[model samples]
Target: MKPFYEKTIHTKPIFQGRMISLQVDEVELPNGQTSTREVVKHPGAVAVMPFTTDGRMVVVRQFRKPLEKEIYEIPAGKLEKGEDPASCALRELEEETGFAAESLQLVTSFYTSPGFADELLYIFEATGLTQGKVHPDEDEFVEAQLISLEEGLELMAAEQIHDAKTVFALMYWQNKRLKAQLGK
Candidate 1:
């Protein structure tokens, strides 16, 4: 086995926005070759899989500008520069679903798109939920829906719930359901 790393020789900033920034980097490969890499820098984010007392999952349907369509997804938000992911998860849940959780647990964290973007996403599971007033960001428009496991699968099959985060939440939710059914 051998180690392969790209050393950045120069970086040119392309654009900076509230959520993300874009840059192009000149790099030296381990094989002594040079190339340019386009990198997207993000502030990371958090997602929450919220379950109601009745076992239905809480999802929000919103219009995504990039996709030019609406999609259903778990409650999620971008992280502040030094914010705690768990806190962000709870906040997003409440803002998006009008639910506050009494129990919140971290499930997993992963990069959304490692090849181009440096966006780390922390996924969480929230239970013991209490309904509250809906309060999404002024620029954000979403409608919360409670769906059964079968409905979730249907949505996934229909590509209504197309993001990786929501798919993962559904799969994890199913695993938990199975474990409980088997008394695990």
Candidate 2:
């Protein structure tokens, strides 16, 4: 009875990987037409926007194999099974940026690709960060740096700061600053 619901008739598992699994689902459309949907299942993830005491935003430059390029993104990582999003946010923030946040606040949770994927992502804002030691995963290579709001804008325009989550974090920061200045 949900709006435009597509009831699944059958699902065939395609491939299962460490982070994601693929499946093809046969569904009956609202209008009685049958079709197949290739879906990606994910264990979810967490992303953090950490701030330095000087107010610069902490970001990581890493190469993404799927993109075949290096991009600047805020600290992020996959959620371990049954992991709390906040804990995952802090873990990623520390592991990627070598910083621990005294304060962590959840900004929002969203589905990255609702059409073909069920990858839910939780975004967090971290303040009062203290530097520590970088300890990325055994196979992960990343370089962390800080950038000003203007620098973030420039990188975004250049596409160095790509990906939806990072772009959303930048926008959120900009909007928060604007609202504060406007006394809202």
Count clashing residue pairs per candidate: 0, 0
- Poorest 10 consecutive residues by lDDT, candidate 2: 47-56
Name the regions of candidate 1 deviating beyond 4 angstroms. none
Give the total clashing residue pairs for model 2: 0
Query: What C-alpha lDDT, on a 0 to 100 scale, does residue 39 get in candidate 2?
Result: 99
Model 2 stretches with alpha carbons more than 4 Å out = none
TM-score for all predictions? 0.98, 0.97
